[model samples]
Each structure stands twice: as C-alpha cells, then as structure tokens.
Target: MDAPTVSRDFDVVVIGGGHAGAEAALAAARVGARTACVVIDPAAIGRMSCNPAIGGIAKGQLVREVDALGGAMGQVTDVAGIQFRMLNTRKGPAVRSPRAQCDRVVYNREMARRVVEAPGVEVVAGEAIELLVEPGASGGSRVRGVRLGDGSEVLAPAVVLTTGTFLGGRLFAGEWEEAGGRMGEAGAARLSRSLLALGLELGRHKTGTPPRLCRHSIDFDRLEVQLGDDPPQPFSFRTGRLDIEQLPCWITRTNAETHRIIARHADRSPMYRGRITGVGPRYCPSVEDKVMRFADRDAHLIFLEPEGRDLDDIYPNGISTSLPPEVQEEFVRTVPGLEGARILRHGYAVEYDFLKTHQIRADLQVAGVDGLYAAGQINGTSGYEEAAAQGLMAGANAARAAQGHGPFVLDRASSYIGVMIDDLCRVNPDEPYRMFTSRAEFRLLLRSDNADRRLTPIAEELGLVSAEDGERTGRKERRIRAAVERLRSVRQGERTLEELLRRPEVEIDDPAIAAALEELGLAADEASEVEAEVKYAGYVARQAAQVDRMRRLEARSIPAGFDAASIRGLSNEARDRIARRKPLTVGEASRLPGVTPADVQVLLAALSGGR
Candidate 1:
C-alpha cells in the first residue's frame, strides 16, 4: 500500500533553509503570518556553503539594510563573527563597507535557533518536491502550498522559494561529477519540474568554492598575516561592541608554476570540457578562468581564512576550481605557503537552476503566479547578503499577499535593496548577479554608516521592527540633525564649522569641531553621520533633487489598456518591447532594456494624448 499523505496548513510556506529561507521565515512570522520552513537537513540551516564570511564592498551595505529592516543576518553575524574589518578605509564613505569572517558552525546554529524559536514559525525537516497550485478566479495559476518528499503536503495561501543552488544542482570537481548542491548535501531533484510547470523560465548559473585545508597542515609562518581592524566594527547596528577575541587571516599568492599547472589541465575542467553549461559570475571567476583570462598575470592573491575559532578547517579564499582532484592537489602545492597543506575538502563547482530575473516583479512575486515568490540564488543573485535581503522582502510580501494587502516595494533612491531588485526586474543577467557599490547610481545616499537612518522608518511602518527600535532610530536622527544645525551655527574664522568640515581634510575631531561635538554629546556612530551629512551637503542635495524628479516620473501612471504601438516616432523594437513588458509607470518603461529616452518621450506623449 502507498504511504498516506499528511496535510498541514500555514499562512506562508518557505522552501529551503539557507540564509534566504531563514530570513524569509523570520520576516513572515514578524508580519504575523503562521509560517512553515521546509529544509532537507534541519541542521544545515543558514549554512555558508561557499565563503565563511559575510559582507564585502556593496554587500556590507546590504547586510546593514537588512538589519535596519529588523532582519536577523546582521545580529547573527555579530554573534558569530571571528574577525571584523571595514574595507576601503581610505576611500569615500559611500564605498566603505564592513566585512566579518564568521564561525560558520556558530552562524548556522544561531540562525537556526532564531528561526526555530521565532513565534508563529515552524521548522519542518523534509525536502519540498512540488508546489501545489490551483486555477485562480482571475484565470491564472496561484500557489496553494508545497508537497514534501515523504508523501506529505503543506497548504498555505502563499509560498516562498529560496532554494539556494539546490534546484537541479550538480557538483563538479575535476573529472568527478555528482548530483548534489554542496559537498555532501543532495540536491532538490524534483523541484525544477514543479517550477517549470507554472511557466516560470529557468536558467543555469555556476558558482564554485575553494578547498578547505586542515589548519595544522598550513605553514602559517611563511604567509603574510592580515589582521582585523584595531577597533573592529560590527555588522549590526544593535551590536554594542565586539567583545570576542579576533582572529587573524593570512595571505599568499598563486605563482607562475600554479598557473602553468592549471593551464596544462584546463581541458580536464568540467567548464572547459563543456560538461557545465551555466554562466558563472564574471567578478568571481574560478582559478582556471583567472589564469586563462589574464594570461599576462603571473600571480593571484589568496587569503587563508579560518572557518571557526575552534575548528580545524581553513578556507582558501581564492583558487576556486573544478579541475580533477589530482590537478587540484598539484596546483595548490605550488602556492608559497600551501606547499605542505593537506586538503580537507577538494574545491569544486556547482551549477544550478535559477529563474530568470525578468520573470519576477519588483516585489519578488512571480509575475503571473499569485502568491508564489522566489529569492536568493534561485533569482540569479549570488551572496548571502543579497539572498538575505531578498528573503526578507519576499517573505514579508508573501505574508501581505496572504492578508490581502498590497505589496511593499522599495525604489532605487531609497536603499541598496531597492537598487538590486530594480536592476533584477529591469534586466535579465547573462551571469549570476552580485552586488557592488558601482551598481547603485545614488550610492552616496546609501552609505553603510546610515542604513538605519534610511530604512528603519520603512521597517517600523511595515511592523518589521519593534517600537523601541523605531524610537532609538528616531533619537539617532534627532541627534544628527541637531549636530548638523549646531555645526552650521558654529564659526571657524570667517566660515562656519560645517563649511570647514566640507574641505575633506578637516575631520570631526578638528579642535574647533571637537568642542561642538563634545557639547552635543553624540555617540561615535551619530557623530559620523553628522559629519557625512555636513561634508557632502551639496552632493546630497543634488541627489535628493534627482530623486524627486525620478519619483515624479514614477508617479505618472501608464494605463493598463494603452497601446504602445500607437506612439509615433518610437522605434519598432522599442514599441514591441514596451508593449510586451506592459510597464505600469513611465519610470519603469524608461528602465526596460532597449527602451530608449526617445521611446520614453513618445510614451509620455501618448499618455498625454499627443499621439
């Protein structure tokens, strides 16, 4: 006899328990939705499958934004961070970002704890093999829930799919290939068919990880040591201070011999041999790619990072590859300090299925499928921070959809989250999308130091944050405003203190400014915000005006039944693209690929009855 099918009900169901799913579940619960998170292995929740670190250039800004919105990633990072550093210290504040090397095991356990202990959230140990859908009253399919591998079903009004590199996943190391997502975890083999059945377009993307070496085997003395900042900064605004002892990472480089070995075995690589068909990230290419692409370069930097304070494994930050195990062994030995290193786990690449970003709306909901949403790597984005941000938005939106509310959407002028989602929705990436500071046009307004100032209000309005947290952010804002006004009034020679601070060379600690800051009694973080505002007042004003103009354009609505083909002077390609996209606003139509400024003008004319 067949096993009996068991059924359970939830307001929202989240599939996959990686960074994205954990945040999704937590966000759903925060929104008062009874959420169920399905995971193949309950112990692997929030697993850092690739790098054992969180936050980088543009990525740190994302983590801060997530935290500002009351997301758990920043808090968990603070609890588990072994080493914290602020990158790009000499650069402008817009590019400065915080990064933390985490205790991977602790990060997972802590995140899992938050998800499990959160009210209204249930952690289910099982693999989701199918999505339950029914015909909608509006003549389209809507997600009803998900079906598990063990003949059980979770019925919900909304579903969030945050399957990080697990759908149709295949791992490759040299000549060896396996059907798994990570080193030892089996892939979600049947979920791809379910997604395709709903008419969602899926594409392939590849990401790889470096080998883990036994810490004791590494000749640490031979490598140059890279230490955390003297006063390490935390990723979370809630973290008062970093109290734990920080660990040091070491750096080495792959020499000419290493490149030569990789080149000799290039044909053996799955990617080069045509076994892996997915497009990999351009910025974080594998070792073979680096060697082959940059043939003139003789060396590539590698950082040896500890997986945890007490663990025996150390991750080599570069040299990710899928060359056979023997070839991996050969090239790794050629690195200066790794000559005596023993590989605890060989480096490998995993190619997985992801939905094309264009198929999802800005709210992360599948375009035509009501109540179905996707986030993280499944949306063609790579990085834990990106995944976490998407998860938070997707979960919150799914909960709102269940409650019969409108979607919460962020815009490019507001936060990095808005920029990422906007970029994803407007264009389909040919390769995996990774966040970078350069990606934001208004990055100067989206600095990491002021994430709370930018997003906490939105979080509070959405009930994602506590009233106490909202009050705290308000106090910080008040202090910053008071400080800026005080600076404007205080005089230094003929100019005000604010004017002096704008000179770039004059810091807040300058004798004249320090006295004013002392009188204000602002905290370090608050003072920094004041400094940035005063220093870049002119640029900030310019950007704010630009934002206003963009918002005005966004406010101009496009009629649902408007005919794009009726517009004169529009290119044939632009008209066809606009008609098919059916953009809801003038601003969105302008952003679509191949839709030129001339096309937007014609669209505006048509909306104004000029055509």
Candidate 2:
C-alpha cells in the first residue's frame, strides 16, 4: 500500500476556519510565518454560524482593538455592513459602541478572500483529526504538526486549534439530536478524541441562533422601523466613510400569545428538556429560557433583521431557540408583526467541546503543551469578537514562539481584550463567557474610539502592523493633540473651550465649539474623542491612578516553575489553583479562584524570598 501523501513543512498550522481560525491564520502569515489554515470546507471559511451581526457594547471595543492590532474583522464588517449604528450613543463615551448588521454572504466571502489572498497563508481543505506531537526536552510533548482525516500529515512547529463549535459537536432541536457543527457542517468528532487522549480536559458549551424567516411572509406594516445611523461610522479606522446603501430593520414585540405558545412547548425545547447538558450563555438566553426566567414580563422585543440585500431571508433576532420546527413557527407567528411569517429554518442548539480556559495561559497557549494554542469557542468564549481577539493573540504568540521571540502579554488596564483574557484564564467561567462594558474597570480609558491609540504602536513593535498603518495612526494622533491644544487655548466667556466643554450642559456641537472644530478641520469623530477625553479627564485620571497602583503587583513576576505547593501559609485550594494555573504575575495569582487577599500577601512575602 502507498503511504499517505505528506505536505511540506509549515511554520504554523491553524485548525478550523471560523472567526478565530481566520484571524489566527492571517495574523501568523502576516507576521511572516509560513502558515496553513486547514478547514473542512474552504468556501465556508468565515461563515457567520450564528447571527450575522458584528460588534455591540463591549464587543465593539474588542473589534476595534483587533483592527488596531492588524486583524481583519473590522475591515470585513465595513465591506459587508448593511445597517450601522453607534449603540449607547446617549451614554458616556466609555460605553458608546459601534454595531453593524452585516450581509452574511458578503462578510463570509470577504473574509475568505482575505484569508486565501494573505501572503504566506495556505488554505488547506481538510479536517484535522489529530495533532502530531513528540516528547520534548522540557518534559511535556511538543506539537509537531496536524494529521488530517485523509491520513495526510502537515508538519509545523506551532498549531492553533480554533475548531470552534465543531469539536465533538452535537446539535439539538426539540427531541432531535444530530452530529453536526453549524447548520450543515460536520463535527470534528475524531479531534475531540485526540484532545482527550492528550490528557486535555474539555468542557461542554451550547449556543443557539434564531430562525431565519422568509422576508415576504412577514407583516412589516405592523412593526416599528429601526433606521440605521445617519452618516454611519465604520468599524475600521482604515474606512473613511460608509457609503453603502443602508437597510432598515423592523422591531416587533412578542405578544402574550407568543409567550403562551413558547410556554406550552417549553418542555419540548432541547435546552429545557435535559437534552442539552452543556452550559449556554446566560446573557443571551433562548426564548424558552427567557419565558421561564422572566415570567412576569408580558412581552419581548424581536428585531426582524435582513440577512442580505439580495436575499429574501430575515432573521428574528431576539427569540433564539432549540424548539421543534412546528413549535417555532407557531410562536413566531404569534409575534405582533410576524403573524404570517414563514420559517426559513428552525433554530437549533449546538453542544460542543471547549477547553477549560484556565488550562490556557494568558498568551492563549495551552498549558503544559508546547507550540499548541487555542482560541474562539474552543476557548469557551461565546462571541465572534472575543474569538477573533483571542485568535490574534494566540497566532501572534505562536509565531513569536516559533521565531524565538517573547510572548506578548496585555494587562486588564491597557485594553478590553486584555481584560477578557485575564478574566477568562483566572475566572474559569462556569457559563459561556461573553464580553460586557461593565466587565472593564478602566473602560473609560479603553473606549472604542481610541483602540488604535492604545494598540497600534504596540502592534507595530511586534511587526503585526505595517509602517504605512503606523504612519496613518500617528497622523490621527497628531490631529487629536492639535485639536486638544486649540480647544484649551480658545476661550469663550471666562472659560477656555476645553473647560466649557467639560460642563454637563455645554455640548461639543455648541456654536463656539463647532466653529473651532471646523476651523481645525477636525472630523466629528475626532472632535468627539477630544471632547470625551477632556470632559472625563479627572475620572480617567483617577482610574489611571488605580491602574498604576495595581501595576505594582502586575509588574512583580512570579518565578517560572515556582512551586506554589511549597507556599507555607496558603490554603489547600489556593495552593492547588496557583500550582495548576502557574500564574506569571502576582496580579494574576491574586485573581485566581480560591486565592484570597491574605493568600496573596503570603505569596508576596514568599516570592520576595523573605518568608
């Protein structure tokens, strides 16, 4: 028998082509690594497996950060966005976010195009079933390559597992169960076995999507229209403006009748029927869960979102479920404006394997496994933004490790992405983790508008951002500084424009302020940033002070291979947790579960070599 054909060696192998896989492969290749992205289907590389929306609340900040780090999500969303809105526009700048409803086909196509066109990136059509590993000099096995289902092997020093909801995936619809990932994709059943065999513990997580309905079948006249933002802002800094035609979404409320239908069939839902044992995102509950949990509420809002400009399918946004097809149709028809709606597809739940993130270090590398990394849903995160951010970090770190460079670490104070990773690794979330603006303690400084300011220079230093991108970012920064100076110098009444703008009643659009911004040639977005920074300066400074004090603990690095078990005063739980997590900094150790402040004090003394 002939041996299976073997591919040439690669510097990095990215498994699965979901959001995380796409960003990981692109980032690694962009960093000059010889990277190969192995996917079950090349055409479905960036398929929007769930909702076709990008960025919301804290998630928007993440996408911005990813873009600033030279990731592709922001750009793709710009091209595919149909309806753009700045969420929380009336709120403080810290919570203000940009969200876009994307044309799923366009978004996926654009991402796939970029991935396939990326330099040094190879799109390999295959299902990776196993990781090739060999005993390492450091005691643990080192990742060598990946083994595909076709029996072909592609050797690489680094491998990023971003398999998403495909590993050991099992879909549930009412009492029905099937082995699949997304709608039509196959589950990577063999890969789950491989991970388990490697002694990696895997947890189960489930997420569901709302049913897609035929657009023509819905009664739109009865629903309230939600218009896109006028002069919409694009997610990418590279995008000057979004000139694409905007589409309107319709808002309709689920009536008591709708709730009754769902309640009657609640027990039939896979999510409620004991069929799905995996934990789902508590923040994004299903219709059944919503009805059961929020029983006092008479109705719920559902946004009828267009799937695409050319497509006739509509997504009912707020009623995701895993109920039967008939039940779905019945409840959907009971909605205020969906009385005649026809189901394009029934919503279903997918339970898949995810690695307990605590086993994954802050840099996204799997603990005790050299050259192996994990990202996205596989890392127990619930959103595309979270996955992409993790992918960027994991891929960059993997490349750095392959090239003998140091791992890139981000702290909670610097970026929302940093806060997310820190939270994931230390919290060891029991439910699927989702990002929220409330999660960031220093969100005032990590606003979506200034993501580039916080991350671009660092990305440039790491070779992830291009010189041209760096120059553009520098120019923007200069414009912002000049604007700030002018605002401070120009006086209206006894107060300078900056001081006046700080007043709650004084608006940035006031005659004097607008005139100054116009004369400076400062764009509205730029002016908004300047105003926010100045107005919130005192609050931001206080937050920065807190961050600085915390940085002392963060700067104190725990010795590599430190014996946490030997710590004399720690509780048994703290000792075990610290030993298992191997936290690199005193800050990280303090955040770990079971490690109390007193334990941290003890740790501080012991690590200082004074205990």
Candidate 3:
C-alpha cells in the first residue's frame, strides 16, 4: 500500500493518551519511528481517575519493566508522589511492592510533559472514529490509518488502541445512572460501533471505586494511623533513590451497625438489583454486596487514605458502593473513623465495554487484523496498574509487528509481562481481571527489584531502551558473574559471596564485598546487583533451570495450522484451547488455564499431524 501523499504519515499512531498509549507512543518513538498519539481529551491525559496512586504487589514489577524499557510511569510517579511505601516488608523479595500516593493533577501534567518532549512523538487531541484498513492481495484487511471525530484522518502503518473505559461507558450509583465514560467525561460513541462493524467481539466488564471523604471532617483520633517504610524503594530502576516524605493513612473497621445499615439498602444497590449488566470485580466488592454475601462476618477493614499532600479528600478504600445517597450517608457515619465524615465524592460503579482478551493474541494484536492492537480497560482488566502494564506491552508489540517482525512476546518464567500477556490471551474471565501474586506460578524468580535484570536484554532486542540501559544491566551482570566465580573459588573460613548473602545479617553494604568489588573495578551500584544475585542465588538458579526447561517447550513448534481436535488422545479442554488460543508454541499451550501433562503429550502427537 504505497501512499500517494506524505507516504507513511507516521510509523505508529497511539489512540487514547492513558498509560498504554503513553507507553506505546514512547516505545515506537524511542525505537526511531515517527510516532503520534491521539487522545480523546487532552485534559484527561494520564488521569488517575480512580486512585491517586500506582504499583502494588506484582503490579510494581511491571512499572520497573516500563522504566527499564524507557517508559515514564516510574520516573513521573517518583517525582510527583507525596508519599512512598514499600509494601510486604515481612514477605520475600518476590512479593514486595512499592506504592505511593500522588497529587493526581501533578501526575497527569508531568506524564503529558514528558511524552510531548520525547523525540519523534506528536500529540493530537480528538476521538478516533474508525480504523482504516487497506486490503492485501491475499485479501485480509491491513490497517492503513484511522479517521478522527472531526472528519479528518491520518495514515500510519500501526495503530495501538489503548481506549480505557470510554466504550459505551455507563456510571451507576443506587438507582441513578449517567451517560459519560466517567462521571465528568463523555463516552466514545463511535469507536465501539466501528469495532463491532469490524467484527471485533466485545464483552461488558465493571469496576467500582470508593467514595472520597473530606479528610478534615474525619475523626482520625478514633482510627489507627499507617505510615510508610523508613527506607522506601522507587518503582523505576532508572531512578536512584526515593526520598519523599510520607503521608499517614488511617485505618478503621465497619461494625455491625454499618452492616445493618447497608443491608437495609441492599435492594437499592445497583449490583443486587437488575440495574447493572456488567460483571463487577470479585476482589473489590461493593459495600452492599459485601454485607449481603458475608453475612457471618462482623466487620471489614477500611483504609482512610489521603488523595495527596495538602488535599482535603481521604479515599475510603474498602467502602466501595452504589447505594442510594441517603443510605450511603447513613452507613458512612456509622464507621468509627468516619463518624462525622462528609462525602466529598460519591461511590459509583462503572459498566464499560471491554474486549474479552482471549480474542487477542499474545502480541495484543487482533488475530486476523494487521497493525491493530488493543490494551487497558478495554481488555477486560481492572486497576490502573494492570491497564498500564498491558498498555505498555501492547504498544511495544504493535511497534514490533509494524516493523515486519514477529510479536514481541516475553516468555513466562522470565518476566511478569510474560505472565500477564499469557493470562490475558488464554484465560477466559467471568469478571474484571486484576493481577495477584497468586496468579504467577513462578513469582519467586521475578521480583520487582530485579525487573531490569530480567527484561533488559529483550528490551534491547526490541530497540526500545538505549544501549546505555543494556550496558548498565550488563555491567551489573558482570559483577554478579565475578562474585559467583569468587564464591566458587573461595571455600575456606573466609566467607564466600553467596554464603555471606545467605546470612541475612550480612548486609549488601558490608565492607568486605565493597573492598573486594572495588579491587575488581566494579562500581557501588554494580556491587549491589551482585549482592542481590548472591542473596537470592539458590532460588535464582532453580528458577533459571526451570526457565531452560520451559524454553524447550516454548521452542517446540506446534505448527501454524495444527488441528488438535482430530488427535485421538487429546482431551476436550486441550482441543478447545488449541483451537481457540492457537498458541504459537507448546510452551504457550502449557501455560493456558487447564492443559494437563497428558494433554501436552497428546498435543505433541497432534503437532506431528496426528500420524
């Protein structure tokens, strides 16, 4: 498809200027491609609509990956954040996460400013109405450009659709409903219609956000205060240290009085009644739903979190509800900390149109469509972190696909990005999906602190990060290698690197390694990497061996056109999954929800054309 005028208007055009779009545009542009971002409303750029925070549990792992690959979430969050806390201090390194509360306004501005300043990136404010698909000689439609709301259009080889919750979005609270995507913004009326016309199958998903209370009005004296860790960790590897002063979050519990009050308004709740059609997230249940379902339970913990420093709003984390205004007011006053609390913003649930991600391939591209990628809330996922993670992966993969290469898929057992992509493309969810530590089977080797080590090589291969990022990671690796060798060589009363690390008492900043590493010409930062390597040596080695085994399966070709159903011994689940997911490799097939050991053996048989 040769262009008549200004051939190849841009290399990639990212729609929706949220986490995913930002990452997509940045990755494409960073890779030396002319990139453009089309956002519906520039005012909403990088808006932290639900929570004024980022990174939690496995979600923090993704943020570091974004930072390692030169995405801006971590760097921006670090600067604009008012509070920083490293969660799960008592837990192992794999489960540890860094969370922070930010001034939402500042976060949006900083993210926008960085993206606009990035080389080869352009920002446009408008709604993308339809995708332009030019046909190939073989006959499937190939994406050529996208049409905007104002009857204008731009051509690009690739288009990443990171449309968050704007597709047929409806907000509900009690019996009242609104037409906007969010309470304040308008929905994307044309985009979803165009998708349906393009034969894209879509599903409905819902997520509820709790109400914000005026912090000054709350009785903080009645609640316990939760503070951040003394020595905090930053989300991005590129960022040096997190030294932000922390804000205190209050904790209170809802008593039987609160439960009874909510119970009386159960029917008025949009969830219990037939008002809402989309499936709500199971983990973040609404207040009315919680009270009715957990009838035996006496109380539920509520975290009173500040929206940001000098802000009056305190977000009621555990009290998400869509109850009537009167009932909400009544139940709110019953909680210990919120006895005199006033609602700054009412809690409401959103029902938005999302693509059932099983329809998307591991690259985040549509199976039959060329250069069309979708990410974020549209992918049937919940939480800002989950959406941002998917957005970045989709953006990176779309850019790769446009370059005539295969999808940029990171294999599972190596990075959280791999686990997330695999899960989204394979598992069929009945509700909005959120990432939990329990979701990843191999999380022991994929800690948030070591994301740069896990993905720097692949990121370099993808041409997203500069050589400096890779060199930094490589130098760190050399330090680890040298220490590993030194440990192997020194086996006397003098402590080995690995042995010293195993003694939790021997710190990473110990003088012995610092002197030895200095003598070996390694920098202090590089020495720290060696320290982590020595500390987690046993677990890392075991995981690497497992990764090697998985790589074999990942490479074991399941032929492009293999038919699993015809195989004599294949189980129904295997056959159905094989037909549905069409996993590019046996490794991917194994990662699907229910393909058993026997199923793998049968799949191998089928891969040989069922001879």
Candidate 4:
C-alpha cells in the first residue's frame, strides 16, 4: 500500500459556497458520508447573495423543511432574524407563512459556523475547472472527480454541482458589461463550458438587487415602523420556544413621483432597454417594470430592512434596480421614505448561466452520468430559501445513494419542499422560478406548521434528522389525533373544535383562552389543532387519495435498465424525455407533462409482458 493514495477522496463533493452548497455538503456529512465543499471564498460561505434574510410567503415552508431535516438555515434565520412576521393570517393553513428579516452578517456567520462544525465536512477554497469522467457499464458516464484551477484533483464517488451564478456569469447594466458573479467575485469561466461539453442544456437568467442605502442618512420619521411579533416565532423547531431581543423593520411606499422618475430613466434601465441578456423573475421586477406594468397604482410598498445588526447597510426591498448611479439617486430621493438617503453600493443586475431544470431529476441528479447532481440557482430557481431546500434534498439523496439506500423524495402533499422540487421537475418554469402559494396543487396538506409532521420520518430514513426528531414528529402527530378524536366524539349543539373554528365570533374559546382559564381550556388547543387540520380537510383528503394512487403506481417499479423506446403509445416528446430522464417509477413518469397517461399504460403493458 503506497500510503493510502495521498489525495483526499470523499463520498460526496459539493461545488459552490452559496445556500445550496452549504446545505448539500452539510446534509451529506450529517448523514454520515465524508463530504468536501469546493468554494470560491471561505468567508462568503452561505452568503445571502440576493438579500440578507430568510423565509417569506411560500418560502417559509422550505425553511421548515430544512429545520425538519436538521439543516442549518432555519437555525441561522431564527438566531439572526431582525423582524419576524406571519403573512396571510386571514388565509387558511396552506397559505399562512412565516417571513423573517435577518441581520445578514449574523446569518452568514451562523451558517458558516454550522458547516465547519459538521461531523464529516471539509471546506476548501478554489474553483473547479472541469469534471473527470470514466466510462461505466452500458455507455453511462461515471464521475471520477473534479479538477480545480489550482491543479488539485478532488475525487469522490459523487459530485453535486451548485455553481450558482458562476457558470460563465456576466453582468450588464446600461453600457457596462463585466465578468463576475454576485458581489464582483470571480466566476466559473470554464466550468459552464465543461458542463455543456458533457451535453447539458444551459440557459441564462438575470436577477437584480437594490442599492444598499446608509442607515444613518435615511429619514426614519417618514417611515412606518413594523415590529416583529409580540412573541416571535423561530424558523427551526430545534430552537427552544424563547429567545432574547427581537428586531423591527420599517415600511414605506414609492409614490407617483418615484415611479415617474424611474419611468423617465427607463431608457437607462437594463431590463427594458435590452442591456441585460437573461430573463428576470416575474414576481420580483425592477422599479421600471413595476411602473410600466402597474401604471394606475399610485404607490408600491417598500420595506426598509437592515442587512445586519453590526452593519450600517439597509436593503430597500421593493426597489430592485439596474439603473445608473445618478438615476438611482434621483429615484431614491423621490420615494416617500428614502428622501436624502445616501447610496452605499450601486444596485445592478447580474446575468449568469443556468441549466434547463429538465436536465436533472427531482433528486437533483444529472442525466447520462452516475454520481453527478445539481442544485440552487444552477437548477434555475431563485431565493435563498428555494436554494437551501433543493440543496437539502440533493445532499440527502446523494448520501443515500452512497450508502446503497433509496432516493429520498417528499411528495407534494408532504412538504412545500416537495412541491418546489416537483415543480422544477414537472412544471419547467418559463422564467426563473420563485416559490408562490399558487405553485402547489396539494398545498392544503402542506403547511409550515406541519413540515415535521409530513417530512421528519422520511428525513429520519435518510439519516439527515437525528433520532430525537422522531419524537418531535410523534408528539405533533399525537396532538393532531387527539384533537380530531375529541372533534368526532363531541355531541351536537354543544361547541366543538370544528364548529368553533368555522364560527367568526367563536374563537379557540368563545371566552378566548387567555381570559377564560376557569372553563375547560382544552377547546382552545383543540381549535388550534382543528384549524390546522380542517382548514382544507376536504382538499387534503382528495390530495391524499391522489398520492395514494400515485404510490401504488410507484410501487410497481420496472426493472433497472428498462428502455422507454420499447414501450408503445409514448408521444415523441414523452419517449425522448423518459429515455433521457429514466424516471424511477410510473408515478414519476406521469409527473412529466409530455409523458401521458397512455405512455404509463404502455409501460405497464411492457413490464407485464416481460414478466
């Protein structure tokens, strides 16, 4: 033995230091596989590239999934969040979500610390030039390792490419075009070419951030103070019920004057003037797009948020721009809340190379190659919450694959994480995908409150969650069942949890639990539980039936090496997609839009005939 081959090799090697890579490398390590994170800078690990915060609207569910599986994002958000708000309280459980504004410095520090402290992870700073592939059986490519620019070869059984905004990343604002990723960092120039060389379909996407304004220069008296919840809620279930010191945020609006200024400078705007080359997110548009699209609206809400407790930087949430400096200053001055606010950094849009999500499976594994995966913005998704969720799933599955275990997939009814992944695999968004409440077909069953209820068991199977998490799931499940039983057992005319939740006037307690402790307080807890379960009980049951039906089809697995071309009735697109994708089950096959029900029947017929 020549001293055990001097080069360090691991079971999984995660590329990129953003949200996805941090979660992916950490998950694989936590699941007991040796993991290495190849990054550009150690200080920037888990950096919030677009914004310095976590959890909002539909995104909160993704954070919850990370928490349920023992990932670090939830913990970091809980610790560093400055302002915490639960949105859509008037809506049902599925639509209700928790949003937080974090001190950016604290958030990144917390995440980086967790990644370094993880059991089986090593973080190295460098750039991967290309991948090394060896020919496996039947013409499939087996990944050997990644070669870095510094001339070091990192070997592993598997590779997860989370090259967010680094694959030939280019930025354009008006006449200016630069070679960089986010924050003027050196990007992966050759890695995108290397991936395309491996025959993956790549696309381009652009996203922008608002210029950071000096906190001291802003007129605080003009803005409305929006404080965090009285009793703040933490994103991580692992965090004990209480914490010290909650942070507050301010809210303001961009008036007609502000919109007019942005419109006047629209010629200089990169988005409309055709200076930027890639598609931007639809939901989050630049000030120019918002003004152009909603001309009738007089004002748009803008949130004044702190980047971190230590830094003087503040993120102006609603006014993402790629305008010139003079135009930005004029527009900032026109806004009701931001008058005389001095800009610290210029807001600009970055265009980066991305993959058409169909190139990878829901588990983030790439086609035509064993032990190769992708996640985060690389997979054509936006937002840190979205990236972290994808990374967690990919990391756990990669770990399971290394252990010779099954792939970890959480279905749509189970978690918003499932809906996000499924949408990536099935819906194939035309633009950069961001999570919205409308994305899920079975959202009624997937709520932020119950992420552990739906996904902790599966996470346990993947060994991403500790054995103790099983108890968290059990306690919640028991409480849910107890409430349901009491609902069914109670007599008519007398108030029940279901009855109380439906009544506008009758709350958890008709007397309201806080004041009327003398009477049976069980009704309040009962109402809370029933409100969660019964909000869309009918819709949830329907989705459950669909899931059950799909699982039955999934259970009837075709043997490995089964060919899709041999099956009849598959449409040309379906046949081509299935052949390239090699989906694991009939259910997965059915999820692909081009693959029809008839194709599934044909596959069933082919498998039965061979049997």
| Cα TM-score per model | 0.96, 0.97, 0.90, 0.94
- By TM-score, highest first, what's the ranking? 2, 1, 4, 3
Residue-level lDDT of model 3, residues 566-592, one tens digit each, is 777777887888776777888888877
Which residues of candidate 4, in runs, are more than 4 Å off? Answer: 1-6, 492-505, 511-527
Cα lDDT of model 2 by residue, 211-328, tens digit: 9999999888887999999989999988888898999999988878889889999999987778889999999999899999999999888988998989998988889999998899
Candidate 1 on 331-397: residue-level lDDT in tens?
Answer: 9998988898899899999999999987787779887777899999999999999999999999999
Worst-scoring 10-residue span by lDDT in model 2: 1-10
Q: Cα lDDT of model 3 overall?
A: 0.79
- Model 1, residue 472: displacement in angstroms? 0.7
The lDDT per prediction is: 0.90, 0.91, 0.79, 0.80
Ten residues in sequence with the least summed lDDT for candidate 3: 1-10
State, as a TM-score between 0 and 1, how close model 2 is to the true structure: 0.97
What's every prediction's RMSD, in angstroms? 2.0, 1.7, 3.7, 3.1
Q: Which TM-score value belongs to model 1? A: 0.96
Q: How many residue pairs clash in each candidate?
A: 3, 0, 0, 1
Q: Per-residue lDDT for 1-611 in model 4, tens only?
A: 12222356888889987899999999999888899999988788888876787888889888888888888898888888877778787766677788888888888888888887888999977888888799865487878788887767789878888888888887755566788887668878899888888887888899988889999999888779888886877778787754657766888888888888888888888777776768889999988789889999999888888888778998999888888888888889988767879999888888888989877776778878788888999999998989998998888888778878777777766778877887888755778999987887777777788777778887777678888988877876776676566655553467655655555555444443323333233333234555666545666778889878867876776556878876666688888888877777777788887877877887777778842
Most accurate candidate by TM-score: 2
The deviation in Å at residue 565 for candidate 1 is: 7.7
